[model samples]
Target: MRRPVPVFLPALLLALTVLGIVTVRLVVYEFGGPTARRKAVTVPPVDGVRITSMTVYSGRLPPCPEPAFDDYGHHDDPVIRPLPTGGPGISATYELHNEDTEVFTYTIRFMFLAGTIQVGAFTDEVVRSVRPGATVRGTVRPETQDPYTCPVTRVKVAEVTKVPDSELPPPPERCPPSGLRLTSDHTAAMGLRVVGLHLQNCGTDDYTLDGYPLLELLDTDRSPVDGARITHGSGGVSGISLPGSGFDEPAHPLVLKPGESAVSELAWRTDTPIVPYLRVRTQPDAAPVTLTLRLDLGTTGTLAVSPWKLPP
Candidate 1:
């Protein structure tokens, strides 16, 4: 004869199954969601700079984008930025301990990641004019990227660059009343480096140009760098080649109307890299503009510049 099943057995089995489901759902929620996506940053060992006092919170950005100026935008005009300053995201402060004897400006790049995946492109945070042996605070807020998720766990450094504020050139800006604007786009491959000089005719008058730009070198203190030679080609940098490298092309006269543009290329190679600044003249008669071009001439102590021409 068959025996009747215990009534408690069915109830216990049901309770166990419900408990398992709840546990699995909680784990999924913890691993992948907005709340779990909150930020935490990690900083690698950096010299003369320390990243500290990081706070991650859930917040929202302003309702609209803000007009701002920087290198990442159009070379000739102000670009609208994401404008996250209304405070709904991850933010961090960095302390720059200037170990050198002179006041220095620090440019730090931060990257955000989610697990093994990067959340957004690396963003640069500037710490300006830090005095020797003194500490100054700077904020690393995302300009266009909203990597609020996993900043604490995922924020990291891509690279860091510094220069004396006095030696640094004016940040790139749009054309002034003079009808011309000058800025640069930086590129690198292995040890070979190139800085593309962009000259724009942003005024009502027609602008004229002939040949390569007048260039000079400056050391960290804005003093002229002795013994550095400026060549007319890429200096035969081995790792890479660029179009319109100013070398083989004969520089001829070109006229650019209002809103037109021209281009040139500066190339060099380096091992330990020196020379932090450049004084560039779009033309000899035109006013010279100093740029923090940061040429790593290595021991070669030479630079190559291409002639100005229309963009490809």
Candidate 2:
């Protein structure tokens, strides 16, 4: 039989057991265990910022949507600015409230709705100097004319990104007019004279053209002809498409490479006095080129030009 256990042995064993329990509790708390869960429950949730009120108005004109709000307290019918005959401008104002305690820089984008098309304009980054529980006002106005048929129905906040100064990609460079050439072919059908304006790329690099070429009629004295106007269309020619292009749509921008060519339709009445020369510039700022061709513009004194595209 063993001798009686020492008194110190029992006390040492009890101390070690208590130390092991303490170590386990510390490990669990450090690793997000029960204690961490209890701490998380007591923490408060974060409150963000929002736009409280928005309004659109122009100089002295009645606000769009008439009443501007609904019974339920939301923006109701869209605002339609009557098409401006002159340059009466349009503008929008927004009231923003920051509910949280943090300072932030914000950006606001406006989407102007015109029929089915939506156009967007934006403001620069605005720093909110006001503290939380305070409100600030921001404004946006369109710089360019609307391209769609419908007037702006209402303005919308497209983006409310929270940043002071965001970086944007650089604007694209306009294509240069190098190694480009212009020529034309004339044909008369159904009492209308049509001239196919052919543009060829004779240089190594590609050339692009959009809309209609700048055109003018010149007399034998090399002076611009008075009272001659030019418009755009195929003059009711059905089934007329660019050669090998298989497209019969309106004029659009086109790209051409070496030896590649595109064509545009130009039509005028045959009864008018004949001009001995034609002047064409690929774009508004480009140098004009003169071609000697006999074109009779008739009493209407107008020329209809179609968009350039690949020949059918």
Winning model by TM-score? 1
> How many steric clashes between backbone atoms does each model show?
10, 8
How high is each candidate's TM-score? 0.51, 0.38
- C-alpha RMSD (angstroms) for model 1: 15.8
Residue-pair clash count for candidate 2: 8
Residue 173 of model 1, lDDT score? 62
Model 1 lDDT per residue over 1-312, tens place: 223457996677578767873221110111122221233234555766666644342222222223455677754543433322233345566666888888777778776544455555778777777888998767675555453223333455665667765444454464465667788889887777888888888789998898889998877656788877787765565443456344657788999998889998887777555786788887777777667666878544668888888998
Q: Write the per-residue lDDT of candidate 2 for residues 73-181, one digit (tens) a residue.
A: 9977655644443332344555666664655444454566543456444443344444566677656566564522334534556544342111111112322244666
Q: What is the lDDT of residue 60 in candidate 1?
A: 28
Off by over 4 Å in 2: 1-178, 234-248
Note the Cα lDDT for every prediction shown: 0.64, 0.54
